[model samples]
Target: MSKQGHKTRANLPAGGFLAIGRDVTSTSDTSRSKPQVHKRELPQLSSGVLKKPRLDFSGKIPSSTPSTSSVKRAEVDDSRWRSFCAEIQIEPKQLLASLESAKEKQKPQKAARLICAAVREIIDHRKEIGSWVEEPIMCSALMLFVKMNTSFLLPHEELIEVLCSLLSTNFPTSSPGSAMAPLLLYKLLMRATDWNWRLVESFIDDSLHERQWTDRPSVDGLIVNIITAFGTRIPHESMYTACDLTYPERYRTVAEINRFTKVTDKEQKIDAFVMQMRDICERKGESAPRNLLRTMCTCAGNGNVRLLAARKMDSWLLNGKLQRYAMELLLWIASNIGQGELTEEDSETLSSLLKLRALKSKQINILFNIALKEILNNDKGMISAVAKLLLSNEFSANRFPYNMTMIHSLFSFDNRSASKVIAREIAQMLAAKEEYLRISRTFFREFVRSLLRMDFDFALFTSHLFNAATEDFSVLTIPTFFFKSLIDFCVMLPFLAITPTIREASQQRRSANGNLTQTHIDALQKFYADLRNFFEICTCFFRKHCELCTDNRLFVYSYYRVLYLAPAEYYTGIDQWPVETDVMQYMRVISDVPISEQLLCTVLEAGSDASVPIDAADTVDVIENLTKRASLSSTLTGSSMVPISTSTVLETIFRITEYKPPPTFNVQDENLPPLAVKTLYWKAWLISLIWTSLNTDTLVKEVYYNYPNLKLIMQIVLTW
Candidate 1:
């Protein structure tokens, strides 16, 4: 054997070779080393030589020999070789200068030629790969390549090919045995400036096409990891920007989008990857939710992917996937955590999605219905989730009213579509089932409470009320009842009502047109006017009784008992209009002299009977627990209303006043009552003479003649 072979054998210690006694080789045979040379000292190569050394063991390495691989290993381990790799660096400017110079000479392809030459040289050096693996050179090279030209560095045609070859499975490792090449590649991809997205898109496209990259057992998961790393370095706003950049125009073809999403297969791997991401997102911790959500929102702009993400979010909510933690995470994301600036598209898409829906409408609406159906069909835990999300402070108040309106429309439409028998059966079932109404009532009450807390300008609330009030009265009985109760509570509850900041809320609301079209307003006004006349007649009945009564306090107490109780009962018994009037009249006669006289002769004559009047002074005095009841005239003027007094007697009196009086009163009184019977009779006379002297109709007509438009404006403002 040649002496060069002996030296090669000496280097193969790990391969269990002995280098004892080999034949001499001629110096003229360049591939064979001389025996004399082998006898001399074998010193390690210096750093400079190791950096770009030429291997002398080519021919000495035998073909078909098991020992050939050992020679390559020895060269890699040389310390000087390792240092050369660590210190290897490229000056980007020089490389660019070289490419530009070549291109300037009229060789248009020269720039790529130079780049290709450089790549080939590095690959051929033999020592460069070893240096790259054993030292820190790889990270620096990757960073430089990415940081320099970014996406511009790669040719559009060659981008995918280059990335796949360069990013093969057998990546280099650090001293710690951690494969860092993949990580370095990932870091570079993430740090990719705007210029690099095209390259990324191309690379992703190629990866999805490759069977090894997609069809493997863990490939989908691996792809997810790649995406995660890629996502971490991208600015949140970039997603929206990218979306804007890609939408409706630039990538005007399906192929272009397919390249972006890397959708390899319609089923199996692709679907599994999408599904896996959705599941992970649903299960993620709070720390990960926003990041993952933003990532998904960005990457999942493709319609199918977006649908998937929406499904996952819905599933997380409905399946109690993460329980309360999921809700909290969703809230945080919905509330825009960590997002510095909101893009219009992001705001629109996200806000529109958070709205609750009971049935499908559009594509997005389908998502809402699916989620609701899943939740309703699956588990009771979902009930809590639904309530929390709908009632949560994070969601918008406008959503519930709109959604509930949609739901009611759906239910009514469905009911109408059913056969008469089915509809009747359903009504029977609903009537029979107490729990349904109870649940529905709770749901609606909470919803109405949300609406009440909304920052309503008078114009908005009136519009809302007017629109609601005009709906088919039969269909909307529940909502109208809710509206009435809500309004009453808003007026009656101490904290809820008495909005000092909006002193003109009532006036402003009355002035606003809202959903009440002119026809509706006119009808409401006429109806209320008739109601006023009826109440006035009842008031007259009470005044006559007050004149006959001897105990003034009892009469006053009984008057309040009737007054407080009448309206609610009458308002509720809307089906029986005149019968309500008769009952109201019977109770009216019990009022104390002054209150009875004021109600019959003065206040009811004004518009006080049309709308319920709350006296501010009465409320304040009541809250203070004073026994003083303002004169009925003062209440008519809305004096000093604060809150209803909690006084035991007053509260009791008010409670009793809310009750309907028992029947058996004489209703046929005509010419029997006369003046001067009591103070009530005298007060009634004083009120009658005051009105008779002014002649209300004549005064109103004269005012209208003087100011023609004033009556119209007053009608618009006061009709409510």
Candidate 2:
């Protein structure tokens, strides 16, 4: 090294740098004196240095070392090797030998490259491998290649192609294997790219073929993942908005619909319909059921398909001329199959189908109406067949009638009066049948309420229903159904005033999204009309039954206790308040009856009996109990009438006759016939009524003398 080079390199270390043919400074204490250069040659470093090269857009990593025969470990953890070795879950050598033998048996590939080429060919061709089906084989192959070569970045085009293939035309995303396919590909895409979600949005549209994104779960899920890949806790509303933004054309406004009417007037032959049914059986998917329903309905009026029951079968099938072809097909099937044709298994299947549709449907479907008609017509021992096909084990007869209140949507159709008539007739039949009555008592009140909603000709139809409803209340030994039947008549009276509340509820559901079609609006209005009329008829039936109060004290007490309540805890808003116009009918009947001496004695006995004293009325408790019952009623019938205040009965009686109530009774009494207190109240209540009716402020005492009384008086006088 030269002196100048030495000076430049001298600062590299405290010891002076060595120059060629120059003296070097001693490294240790030998340099204690002023350091003098020692003669030395320049030393070379052991490790070689090279400059790094710049990377281009190709993004390929440069090789670090020269190629060798020995296998080299790449930038991966020990677990990856463990994973690759444990793929067969066996010793590495054994797995290799097994794979080698399998490979030889399948194809005599000379090298691993040939097998790789064959796999590439399969991916390109989209063929199913020997035992592995198309989905599993392709999905696994892609997963294996990416997982093993974790650093390898796949081309965006190939990734898009793979994603697109899994979601080809008519593929069912909800099916087990199919739903998982896109998820797997999505995972692969995640591993394979640093691509933006925007890229996926652009490519997914290009990739999707036949089905719209909203139509299938897989597509929707895939699209959601694309939009929210890097996001967390996205709301459902935002997801919907994302869908609307991503695919504007598919989710057009209802006003943009070009069709004048929604009805699809397709005509298919019977053979075509059968073939469609066969396809439904062979294929696997959610779409299959919907498609099967549509195809069958499309074949309506084909050979052997007749509309025997509802004359406007076409209109019902068309269902507001669109959007309900499925229901019509189910009805058509039941009607066409007739009695004795369905096997036990077939019956079970049909019943299950009806149940599934019923659970999913919001309105009364055609299947229900058809089943009801089968029950009504009772042709060819069809009741048994209809029973087997339409009724599920989940519900006894009572629940069916309970469900029918809203399902009476068929009331909006042309057969409206007949449908109501059929329902009343069904209830009568069920009531008559011991088996049905025992099991179906749950629905006793519901059937009565539904019957009351009709365009009733009381003399012709309702008279019989009311007779059945009020049947033999004289007998304390009656089924629970009959008991509920009486309660239904009383409670339903309040509903006559609350039609506007129901109308508001119907309107909220109708116009919630501002998507109400004219057809839907009309149907809803008609349905609301049917319900309004249904509850109003209770006024007439109740007025007819006013005689019961005078005849049966037990019923009279139950009626007054259930029907009236305190004003403070009244449950309804003004809209919910039923009109009190018909109140005078039942109220006046309850208002002014004379108190008999015999009744007063009964009241004194009821009050004096320590073990049977009635509970004092608590407004809070009364309102709470009424609220619970009202909630239960709403749950059962989909709508509930506002409950009357419990205090009303006492208040009305007090205002009428200025009668004071008896002292508060014991609270813990649990005596039999549970109406002990109400009975006492009724005894006093009727006195108020009588006082009002007589228009008298007071009653004078009276005594009658008989011969026995005179003789007893003379004997007492003689003794004195």
Candidate 3:
């Protein structure tokens, strides 16, 4: 027969097995001495019968030493190899028969050679064969064969060149075949722990730059693919210390990645990387691991892949253009760090990042407004998510940098309409369920601070809100520190003392009676006016919450703590409290709640011995240790439902009215503020004012009998 005709006949599909050209020159490094690969001539198919390769456990692989691509006899699994060949469409039984026949002849290398030829054939003709090469079966076959019989692997250097060549030279980068061809090579090389990975080292060393792969992107992606694939099989991939893989060295890249990464406009590169990540997240689900975020933070520990974008956030001029990109990137990363639900630690990291980059007050407002808008514009699901994040403990407290500025942003935004909604929603949310208070405590306290900063009109609005209350607002849910902070800001210290900025602004007119401009006086008057309704609303809320003692003991304890917050006091011309009776009525209502070491101290320390309310009554000798603890941390167990009745308060009040302190000033003896003394001073000033106002219908003059004997001390100790 003619040569071409013979080749055509030889190419025909076999009945059971198609005879293939076989070549094997260098299987192991020792075999490299005779490195020439000579192809065997093919004639026709044979219906070869089945037989298994002999097991050889004597050539056992040391578990301590990871195996190289150069396979050992004992590493060979006879059944797995057969299964692998079958997956690659080799007809396992026939391939086994051929292998067994070769072994009989002491030439098992021939079957290895045939399998390699078949793999190469599929790879080379992947396009002509369509998606067949993309099949999972094909991938599994290639991985299994290379992993099980690595001793039969194509020469390491040659295989690297061949795989790159097939993808870049023979196929288009966009082709599925081009993308997936390296998967098998990647498996083989990665499994071969002894491999020097000269291809990778050469790229990093730039040895291949002179003849660099033209379809550079394809090669770059394949390299990244290889690196990630290696991650999958690692024992503890997230912990590099546990694995031997040198990630940085492995990640060292050539043309495509380095090309774009080397671009001059660092912003452009960062934007590109971020957009790429965004696309990835959109393709995958939101909850998928944020690889890019991990990469930016973790990999950048060594400063990789345009990591300077985050570090240089402050240097970028907000020329209005570049900041948007950086902002978008930051927001994207923040949102995805935990799929629109960052954990506490992630929230802290984000807070630090923003704080570090927040160069100006305006920038804080901008982000604050954005966070607020997310809550305002989106559905409840998004609101809850954004609320959790934007109001995370890191950003909601007095300590966070720019937290006041954040509040100010809301104060000044779109006439503070959004801020109003936020405050109302928070109040209603907390009041409706006790759990909301625990989770959203800092936010509520900060919102209350912001409310204190608002004008008289806003305070009146909030006051009316509680008066016509509809929800289940519980003061017991309010954290003890929260109420204690309120006392410090409103009663013990000037309201402006809470924030440094406001304090500094008020330095010139620190006191209400100080020499001041009309504007300053007007501002002070408005602030104080805001306070009347503010404290009154707080009083009303506490009074109502006091009623909740029937609800629980925590409510019971928290109510009395709220009463002695700054000690009982009367007001003179403040609109809310006019007469001593009104003051007394307020006290009676709060004390009248049906519900401690803590109880005796407050009653004695706060009630007057012999004075009544006056413009400026003699300052009472201050009571000591009647100070409420920093928080109801230990004492207020809230373990029962019975309220502390008005009778208990009345008994304690009469008993302590006669008590006296050592008549010496050891005032400098303690470093902590004299909160109890100051509280008594204010109480004395208000006690005479606590007489029955006789105006209300529900409260009768007879309630005065609740503590008539206590008014004797009310005559002497008026609150300043």
Query: Which candidate number maximizes lDDT?
Result: 3
- Candidate 2 differs from the real structure by a C-alpha RMSD in angstroms, to one decimal, of 26.0
The lowest-lDDT stretch of 10 consecutive residues in candidate 3 is 50-59
Model 1: lDDT to the true structure: 0.33
275-360: candidate 2 lDDT, tens digit per residue: 43344334422223333343333233232222211222323334443325434444444433433344444344344433442433
Off by over 4 Å in 3: 1-309, 312-332, 335-352, 355-651, 659-720
Writing each residue's lDDT as its tens digit, candidate 3 over 291-394 gives: 23333322121222223334344433243434443443343233233323434544444444445435464653454355344323323233333333344434
Judging by lDDT, tell me the better candidate of 1 and 2: 2
Q: TM-score for every candidate vs. truth? A: 0.33, 0.25, 0.31
TM-score attained by model 1: 0.33
Off by over 4 Å in 2: 1-406, 414-465, 469-477, 497-552, 556-720
Show model 1 residue runs off by greater than 4 Å.
1-101, 120-156, 159-198, 201-297, 300-441, 444-465, 468-720
